[model samples]
Target: MDEHQGTAMKKKSSHASAITMNKDLEHWVSSEEQADISKVIQERLKDKKPKGKCDICRVHPAKSICIKCGNSVCSSCYFTMVGLCQNCLSKDTIEKWKNKKTDWKKILEVDWVD
Candidate 1:
């Protein structure tokens, strides 16, 4: 009857509705239907192949692809450490060194100014 009691009843109803909705969803699909859907998905995935030419050699068929950049690369150009094609991984390394060089230059400039 009071505002507090009304709010509590609304909260209880919402919670009960959520549980009922979840229960309804649990039986929405039969086990056979689920199995069929999963089988179809697996078959489709199995047919999928990595796309693009080798990023490094640019000639060989790419056997592996980088998960991050999705760059197709041959086994020879694939770097396992970073899970990237050699070209991408080397660019990352070079960028890091460039940043470090700029940082060192800035530090030296500050020291000289002082």
Candidate 2:
């Protein structure tokens, strides 16, 4: 056969193979009764403490405090130091404080709430 005809046949074979693979996957899941298995898996995977208190808010466990501004922040908020709710602090300043190379007494003092 010509190169063009060979390519067309190869393409058709690939498409048929893909359809067959998908059908096999669907049948495998159906035979195992995936929905019930998944439900049991989910129940087993359920966390003991499914929902915990907010880390930032004093109403909950405080995760970490910002170096520039002494505001309590959660694990998510700790990485970024910029945003509306963000307490923006330069990374350099935090490093200096951490190393005890600078006196950040003023910044370190927590005064987030009355």
The residue-level lDDT of candidate 1 at 2 comes to 100
| Model 1 ranges off by over 4 Å | 1-48, 91-114
How well is each residue in 1-105 modelled by candidate 2, as lDDT tens digits?
Answer: 999999999999999999999888785567458678667645644432213443445355546544444455566556553321244755676566457753355
For all predicted structures, in order, the TM-scores are 0.33, 0.29
lDDT for each residue of candidate 1 in 2-29, tens digit (9 for 90 to 100): 9999999999999999999999988868
Task: Note the Cα lDDT for every prediction shown.
Answer: 0.72, 0.56
After the best TM-score superposition of candidate 2, give how far the Cα of residue 87 lies from its true spot, in angstroms. 27
Instruction: For candidate 1, report its TM-score.
Output: 0.33
Question: Which portions of model 2 show Cα errors greater than 4 Å?
Answer: 22-28, 31-36, 39-48, 53-114
- Each candidate: RMSD: 14.5, 17.4
Worst 10 residues of 1 by lDDT: 105-114
